[model samples]
Target: MMMMLNNEESEIVKDEKSPCEKPIKLIELSEKPRVYRIPNFLSDEECTHLIESSKNKLRPCNEISSGVHRSGWGLFMKEGEEDHPITQNVFKKMKSFVNLTDSCEVMQVIRYNPGEETSSHFDYFNPLTTNGSMKIGLYGQRVCTILMYLCDVEEGGETSFPEVGVKVKPIKGDAVLFYNCKPNGDVDPLSLHQGDPVIKGTKWIAIKLINQKQQPSNNNNKEGSCAP
Candidate 1:
């Protein structure tokens, strides 16, 4: 009877411990540029929560250089915004999913209405240009980027890589992860990408730029850069 009771207690303890949540599903979209798509990165409720929380914070995007053209509103989250419960949860999942270990820039949420889009641009800073070199010196090269789609659009708003002929539709809760640097730490030119115009409905997205090193003390660096 004593042995049977002990066995029953062990089974009860095992039943009480819940199973761990499953990781996000990753689909390889490219190899050379190291692009991937993560489906169900966020739940519908989580998507809505992020959209509602950041909608009012939107403003004109801060173009890193005059050569780049962007037609959209963006908001870079505050220093402690990551500590917010909603954003913190999302960040935790993203960090784990990508095996991200380096420091990251402040999160930026963007909104695009009909006819709005961003011209093709590279995520890494151009070492040749003065401004780009300065940014790189301060923040280091952007190693990777995680663009999370907060809502689905009715008509357009796909992220397109023209050279690779790859176009990813804006799907709520889906995320696109791409590497900006090669294995040898050199920036890749093939990382060029653009946000296609939204023809029908509005589009909402949140971008997290992962840097090669910890950001500097000054947090005034602008986002988005391109070659002339």
Candidate 2:
């Protein structure tokens, strides 16, 4: 079980235990639909590999708006047979930790240069009006989002969920996990979040958006199945 070390007004503190040997230090950013942070979720070697492999494939973050609101170089890695061991291991850890049979969407690698910023946005897409593909087995909706930090920032670049008063700084090898929808399957407004502007240094990160799994399970998996 995940150990809740303490509960503060704005955040919950704990050291989350995973299926893997490595223990994670968690900070609960929200309660409803759950938002938590996992320190040291990846190794330095893994972070370096992810950044190097996706560097050449980088492109502007938002194709439509371009560099107006959010400006950055980004790349994506989709699931396939041919994947690096580190990449595959990441998938395995996420899958096992979340207890989800449904696969993840294409992993996104994003880098924010100084002065670049992303406006606040909610992650869950409307089921009826959504245009993008959400299917990957039983996942018709985006349930969980797991973000990993590839590099540390020297100044700004903090992820904020304003409604919950949560702000997480980019820490190398750490991860932030949250749910887009509530237990009732409705999009939670509290899930609204934003990537604060990078002031002085560059920010490197990876995103794994997980869809709902189709398999039936008695496991009551909330965000991540880690016990603190």
Per-candidate local distance difference test: 0.74, 0.69
lDDT of 2: 0.69
Against the true structure, what is each candidate's TM-score? Answer: 0.82, 0.79
Could you give candidate 2's per-residue lDDT for residues 177-220 as a string of tens digits?
Answer: 99888888777878877888899888998887766655343222
Q: Candidate 2: where are CA atoms >4 Å away? A: 7-19, 64-68, 78-82, 100-102, 128-139, 214-228
Superposed Cα deviation of residue 3, candidate 1 (Å)? 41
Query: Candidate 2, after superposition: displacement of residue 102 in Å?
Result: 4.7
**Top candidate (lDDT):** 1
Candidate 2 contains a number of clashing pairs equal to 5
Clashes of 1: 0
